[model samples]
Target: MKYQYEFFLPQNPKPIDTITGDIYDCEKKADEIVAELGINEDDDLIIAVTEVGNND
Candidate 1:
């Protein structure tokens, strides 16, 4: 699986490409990053999504 995240600011015109997940995980990694950035749901929205890919 491939995992990544997008962070959006209400006042910004485009989304910010935040950190990418490691080979094994996504959600916990995102939580850690959001804490580091010090922003919560009211300040912005962080979305984590995953897509499955071929083993090759």
Candidate 2:
């Protein structure tokens, strides 16, 4: 199994364009984005994790 991380802005119900437009392999990479973009809690950004590939 594998996982991918993505960041979304303003909430999850919106279209993907609302995303931060980046994909990360791990939480640490995502955290780097938070620092780089100066994202705060008030920023309404979301870090979503999704499963990828197949275990088989």
Predicted model with the maximum lDDT? 1
Pairs that clash in candidate 2: none
Model 2 Cα lDDT, one tens digit per residue, 1-56: 56555567675564232222224345556566667767773465575666665546
> Where does candidate 1 stray beyond 4 Å?
18-24, 41-43, 48-52
Q: On a 0 to 100 scale, what is the lDDT of residue 40 in model 1?
A: 76
TM-score of every candidate relative to the true structure: 0.42, 0.49
Residue-level lDDT tens digits of model 1 in 1-56: 44455656567766665555554455565466578777775456646455545445
| Regions of candidate 2 where Cα sits further than 4 Å from its true position | 11-25, 41-43, 54-56
Best by TM-score: 2
